[model samples]
Target: MLTTRLPTKVEPYRLASSGKCLEGVIPLADMPRVVEAIGVQESDVRISLTFDIDSQRRSFIEGSISFEASLLCQRCLRPTEPEPLSSDFRLGLVTSDALAAQLPGEYEPVVVENEQLDLLSVIEDEVLLVLPQVVYHEEADCAVSRDQLASGVEPEASDAPAVNPFSVLRTLKDKH
Candidate 1:
């Protein structure tokens, strides 16, 4: 989870080439927007992050994130477990003066202070970025109900039973 308390206090520096950090699974209950965004139930949430910091002028933070989640299919409204979600991106830590020069227009620059970085915020951003906009299940596994298909009646077919007018006339004469 990456965060910024004070933008100015963050000092810019190169990242360490290698490091290992792990955060326990965060409870997904309070984060309703995030859960809805990912289309996953709060119970199935899991996140694991691994990162490597580069030693360049502006060291690059490279990492892979994996998530185990379940989402509802859009068409059939069935629960689906997609292949484990994973994504990779770089974190560019820079100072106020060199912020624009170091970070390109496309890359998101995270401001750092006092040569310290918040690990949690970084992980959060990465997680959100990896989620797909729309969630859906495979067609073969979808669970649409069969009854819904049988209810639509064809316009040309009338529901009333056929009766002969001549038979009715003969029956009336016999009765008289």
Candidate 2:
């Protein structure tokens, strides 16, 4: 766990050239997009990033992000217990679309403008990607029970034989 706040922006090329590694924390409240998506956020996001020039001569950032979040439960429509979420990503830093396109499939291309990358934005993007599409508590913990979900009135059984509309069509065809 990192207690120091991370820099919001950095020069990826410079970091990569020096083989720098950054480990820090970003307050969850600072990321509005994440807050909006998760509904509730009360903790800091732990981030670790290593910047290096790979053997392929590609400058990239390998990052890991972890955080606890309280997401709205799809079943109960309420906030669930804080759940841990994390993501690991490798981003190839590029200054142009051509360079971005040349990056291999293993590396997701990140375009740097004016040689400066918004580190927070990248971290926030990873956090968003890691969020569960539909959050739900364990069956025992959920407020809405399976029985309630399956509780619709069952159709009453009748003694009469079922009538088929196709029977009339069959009768007409036989008469012809």
Candidate 3:
């Protein structure tokens, strides 16, 4: 895939009869947390986009994306290489003035231009959206038991006092 940086001018911005689109890889290993959490075994991003003018009033481009990323196994905290998933989305672009009038205050807008498409931003969003909330390690020869305690000792705690914090608070309140 092409680098994450946006090109000088995205094709969609220009008032051209036809616009060209690009697709390529973006190296996200720079994000340490993302790399550590989602250990990518093998990843490739595929993007298909088109830019066109809509009735001389608005410019628009549609993007369809598919990518593969690995998730760390939850059981052993190891990397689980899963197949890539695809995401389909579209972005709308308008001038700052138009956006101020039409878009919500909290909404983010993508800008289209004369030469290239801002594919990197879209890819980042897609990856972020698809990342699983919890990554689980597959059950291979390396499954860790949930019952096992970290101290390597049985979880039976009989040598403890039967005092409760709430009870102490109640006694203090009564004394006052």
> Which of the numbered candidates is closest to the native, going by highest TM-score?
2
Instruction: Summarize candidate 2's per-residue lDDT along 26-97 as a digit string, tens digits.
Output: 999999898888765889999999999999899999999999988888989989888888889999999999
All-Cα superposition RMSD per candidate: 14.7, 4.5, 5.9
* Candidate 3: residue 57 Cα off by (Å): 3.3
Q: Give the TM-score (vs. native) of candidate 2.
A: 0.82
- Please give the TM-score that candidate 1 achieves against the real structure: 0.53
User: What is the C-alpha lDDT profile of model 1 across 1-176, one tens digit per residue?
Assistant: 34212121222243233444333454434345666665534443344333344443445455565666666677677667755677766666665657746676544677666677765556556667777667766555667645543668667977898777689889889998
| Better candidate number, 1 or 3, judged by lDDT | 3
What ranges in model 1 sit over 4 Å off? 1-33, 39-56, 97-101, 104-108, 113-116, 145-176
From the highest TM-score down, the ranking of the candidates is: 2, 3, 1
lDDT of 3: 0.58
Please provide TM-scores, in order, for all candidate models, with all chains considered together.
0.53, 0.82, 0.58
For the record, the alpha-carbon RMSD of candidate 2 to the native fold, in angstroms, is 4.5
The lDDT values for all models are 0.55, 0.90, 0.58
Worst ten in a row by lDDT for model 3: 1-10
